[model samples]
Target: MILKRLQSIGMVFLFLFGLLLFPIRSHADSAAYVIDETGVFTSDQLLELNDLAEQVTNDRECGVYVVITKNMHGYSERDFAEGLFFNYDLGYGLKDNPSGIILAIDYNDRFYDVYSYGAAGDTFTTARLDSLNDLVYDYLVKDDWFGACKAFINKCDELLESTGYVYHTIQYTDPTIAPHIVETSPEQRRNEFLLRLPFAALGSSIVGGISVMVMRGRNKRTGLAKNADQYIVNNGVRLTQSRDMFINRTRSVTRIQRDTGGGGHGGGGHSYHSSGGTHSSGGRHF
Candidate 1:
């Protein structure tokens, strides 16, 4: 009985030691900058965005990281964003206080937050971050994950470049648009043409049918008289009086309304302070 009791105690101690030694690991450092835990990005798109993030960080000397997960582990949007930025150890700035920005998106919760640290917070004002959200909100609503992420990166890069931190960096060209016209690839144009072909063919067929019906009606009416004029002897009747009659005429004018005031201005900018680091604004929810 004593031996059995000792063995049981020993097994309990061993189990407790195992539990202490093999605690669940946090996913904090599992990714570098962009983490798509929900598989929101395709292979090619993920590669492109990761490359973009790396390039931007190297060029600007500040981290522009993105984290896309299914949930935020019960933290609020802002807290999750700030926590991730710190836990991930993102930023290339000074050792004392790192500088960077992180865009955290929780797919399951349909929540997104943009958190900035150090110099990034100073550069990315509240209004500017809101504008960035504006660029991506519609795309996100439409489930265009890649488009939304690309927009976020593009806008961030542009804003960073504007601050003179990163100068003369080549911009990301949106394949969806050029100067005034939407850019269309050859395959896209072909697909469009193919999609409209049936409609065009139907329209042509309808017009052809109408023409044929009109021709048949005309054939049936050939040489037929609707009045007694055709039956009258050639040049048998003569008119003595000829006069012109005036009809009423009218015209219409459209009044054009002009905008009387210039564009309205916006309100004051705001920023959030987190753990002594000032972050930008905007938390989007679906």
Candidate 2:
């Protein structure tokens, strides 16, 4: 009886130990946003991008997916992209009205597509999606997978910000936020202001002193005209009956072109497949 009890206790301890050694898999592993089957990105690069993509998806409550496949699997780039999003259940939000965006690329065919669903479709405008593709193309052409992925992530972050989505975990400094002026911490700004205060004061003093001296010299050189008529020319000023005349009023109208989101001259647009999935896609031969 003693031996049997000891055995049971040891079995319970072993069971608890097994739980720690073999932890349950996270949803990230199952619903990975970055699927680089072509091995374009290194393991480290893939891990980094996956973390970024997952965070953006969660924050936006919308998906931002990327798939780098070896082939199109018998479907066009656009169709394949939409099918992948649908099949893999890649979106978030309501089941009937899921929201997400996907970027599918086939390195073998040099084809790529960017598509949005539900809320993401509304957030990522057609023009912005095409513009994003244009931005990523520069790196794709150079075979810089990591660079392209980074660009895509950064662009998505910016678009989300436009829709009032703020990312706090990682701070990415955008120079365009405040052009020419570099951002500084409070202490740095105060130190800089203090350092420049003396020079600013000196410059102001010099300018003020020069103006005062000039005004004093002018005062010394001239006396206020004792009489207004004394300084006036006899017929220097003449006023004729010149009524305010309006010669043909001219009006110029500028036609502010609206962005149709058909991608610019060489840009692309979104299309729908038979399944009713919308796709905003663009690509070129590398």
Candidate 3:
């Protein structure tokens, strides 16, 4: 009995010691600033970038999101960024008037786009975004993923600190502009359709369930009251929710511009619009 007790104590101490010796691992997706879905960065690099991004985002009151994915999710760079931003709620200010920037990179396509919204758009103007893109172009081209991310975070901090960005009251026009002019190949459209079928089925199931419940309720009522206090009590409330599913190959466009923000090497032929808002923006292939 004495020997057994001693061994049990030793095992308990060893477990406690191991707990202190090993580091707790964290899931990368839990990190909001830098989401490396491509898994290219090491733990140390991700930790460093997350620290820097968090610090700067707090200081500037504008979020800096870096999303490096394997592919574009069958959508354009602009749409991917916009959808992720709103869907994930990636901004610093109010929901309606959010302020942030996203550097979305499609690793397989070797393409990247910089998108900014609210005050960040004005702060990171066409000129600023262009210059920012140029700053990371070389690093991306060379496959220096860590260097590119660090440079991106640092450059955003630099621009936000500077006081030269042009700010104007941009009056947004019909944000409903035309669909993408480029013809989406049949193969791409088919892939998008396949992706949406599950959602369509889910919606149909919900609507059918509601209809059946309504019909059953009517059948349960055998006779209607016809005297005093015959009126319905109206004590209970019924709520219904529905969503529209649009599966298409149309690209969103924003042709209006208010401020060019100033001085850059990269040129913008047409301004880009995001899916969630009418923010001023720009983009290009590396």
Candidate 4:
């Protein structure tokens, strides 16, 4: 009984070991690539590309394949052609050879092309191509691989809608004429303001000081003119009131001069006399 129990245990252990080995083999088989001279790709590169491809395919809920061709080979070549094979001679084609999507990276041109076997061909420029690669690296490789791939494909679809496939072309223009940047959220704006607050505050202080100085000079000139006008008006009013009775005295002097014949300026023998009392105006006159 003891021997039988040990044998059963050994069989159980073997079974578990085989179960573990199965996944290892399956993974190895599933991840296959075709590397060649001028392929311009390393094992790590292929692995990364494969990971992105799998992510896109898995999210679409459709079977898709990613194939990289050295010097753009697959564009005009067939899967069964000689010297055309993936890792372990596994052919590079749509899943089950059915109509599907394929993301082909041409290492030679550093350009990427997306082809829907039965639909259309879309191309990406160097910058946009780099953006797609970055999206794969950042989102697919680092974050949710499936979600990133799906989002990328969706973006490609949106691009296609506007300019068909030509939307991938890059526009070179003067940086000064570039469109206004999109506004950021309040939090982002606040952070930006804080980052630039020192310079902004310094500029505001300079402007404010200059404005205050100008206003002060203007007020001083205005006040001086206003005070002089008020003084002149007050003195004129006081003199007029104090000299009201002097008007009759001035008339009497004028009559006396007329009676003494002093009005005849051409008479050489004419004599003029002055009044003994001196009249004074209330305000000093120069």
Candidate 5:
């Protein structure tokens, strides 16, 4: 009975192993092409990156082919640099080169790089170097394929303004100024004037008060001038001195009045006054 129990245990272990292997085999079959150069990447590392690309392309419905060069013989350092130049050049030629994205790894340097060519008008820039590295390492290396591809595309947009690579065409639209200028009928103008009447009356009242103050000041000066002659007679002051004082006070009052009321009226009934006698005054009001 002990021997029979041992046989049963063995059978149970075999069954579990088969179950686990079945899913893995099925997954391997469904994945897109996964090329790994044994010299460049260990079998385990290749499998890991393959699984990552598979998961991402499957989710995003994108065609992804992962190529790994194990030995420098078939894919040397010169070969890789030429490959990048070729891809960039070809993309420029075909104008559709940005669709293919490459994730290249330099095992010697322990660093990886991602190059993407987005749609037309989208080009690469130096500013995106760091972000592209982050997307490849953080997302692609982590098997977040969908996130990596999306982030790559977004990085392209972020680089557009700073890239200095102008697209094929400049999009322009005519300025729409007609909407800003509305044609109002006589009735509308009357209504607009009525709407502004209260403010206009307030402004007029202010102006009238200012005018009254100015007139009162003039009247005071006139009275002072009349009394100046009396002072000259009583205090022995000169007539020339009295006349000069009256003229200077009148000139000051005129300047103040001009400063308070000299600009055009607009939608608002507030008057805009300028301090300078010349048209190019220091202040302006609308």
Candidate 6:
């Protein structure tokens, strides 16, 4: 039996050695967020973006992914992006809702899409995705691939923060909950503040000037009788007893035209290109 024991130990040793020689890529690894199949990003960039995505995913409880591929692999832009998300099983937690958002880039095809699934879909509504699509497209048009991915992560974080976890939690748990509405972003708010800033400044300046004048007027210590008679100079005192008459009033009406055309944002929604999966994407062709 000594020979049999030696054979078994030899097999065990080989198995252990093989594991060391070939390490498997697990989901727990650090670079799970940014998957670059095209070799577009350097090691340092991948790590940095991966960390950012991971932190956002954890804080938001929804995955944020940036997936770059050479081409769509013989599939349409929408099909390929959704397919990758599913086939890769990319998401957070093993729950029913494998909620995640993907910014898929097809470098060869000159096309890109921001796909959102499960709870992420509910949170990243069409309007928000459109905004992100526009933001990323600006970078991609300039061949700023790294900038696009970086901006994608940062914007996702910003959007998620504004809505809190309402979309991620409420929708998944109770379908009856009122949907989360991402009405405004920090950028939009800042723009509004800027628009009103000039008016605000003007009002403040006027108030300040008036206050100063009032203070100066109060400090003059007026001696009424000294100069009042000389200061009041009337240029020809002539009075005619005439009454002013009222004239007829005329009114002009201008018709206000209405625009029947819908907004650009109406083109997006929760679409199910195929069963077993659903996503929201306003694909951009740059």
Candidate 2 segments exceeding 4 Å error: 1-31, 165-277
Candidate number that wins on lDDT, 3 or 6: 6
lDDT of 6 by residue, 140-241 (tens): 999998899999999998888887743332123332222222233232344455566557757977998999999999989867565555665586445667
**After superposition, which runs of candidate 3 have C-alpha atoms over 4 Å from their true positions?**
1-29, 164-286
lDDT of each: 0.68, 0.67, 0.69, 0.39, 0.40, 0.71
- Highest TM-score: give the candidate number: 6
Clashing pairs in 6: none
lDDT rank order: 6, 3, 1, 2, 5, 4
In candidate 1, the residue pairs with backbone N, CA or C atoms under 3 Å apart (3 or more residues apart, or in different chains) clash, namely none
Over 200-276, each residue of candidate 4 has an lDDT whose tens digit, in order, gives 65687799899999988887753334355646654475533543354443333343334653432242331211110
> What digit string (tens of lDDT, one per residue) describes model 1 on residues 154-190?
7778778878763221212222212211233232345
Q: Provide TM-scores for the models.
A: 0.51, 0.51, 0.52, 0.25, 0.26, 0.54
Steric clash pairs (candidate 5): 37-68, 37-70, 39-70, 40-70, 98-117
In Å, residue 147's CA in model 1 sits off its true spot by 1.0
Ranking by TM-score: 6, 3, 1, 2, 5, 4
How accurate locally is residue 216 in candidate 6, as Cα lDDT from 0 to 100? 94
lDDT of 2: 0.67
Which model, 4 or 6, shows the larger TM-score? 6
- Which runs of model 1 end up more than 4 angstroms from their true locations? 1-31, 166-274
Cα error of candidate 4 at position 183, Å? 51
Q: 128-222, model 5: which lDDT tens digit per residue?
A: 44455565567645545435444554454345435544423212122211121123323234446655655765787799899999988987743
- Residue 209 deviation, candidate 4, in Å? 99
Candidate 5: where is the Cα deviation over 4 Å?
1-34, 39-45, 61-66, 70-98, 108-112, 118-126, 134-286
Candidate 4 lDDT for residue 159: 40
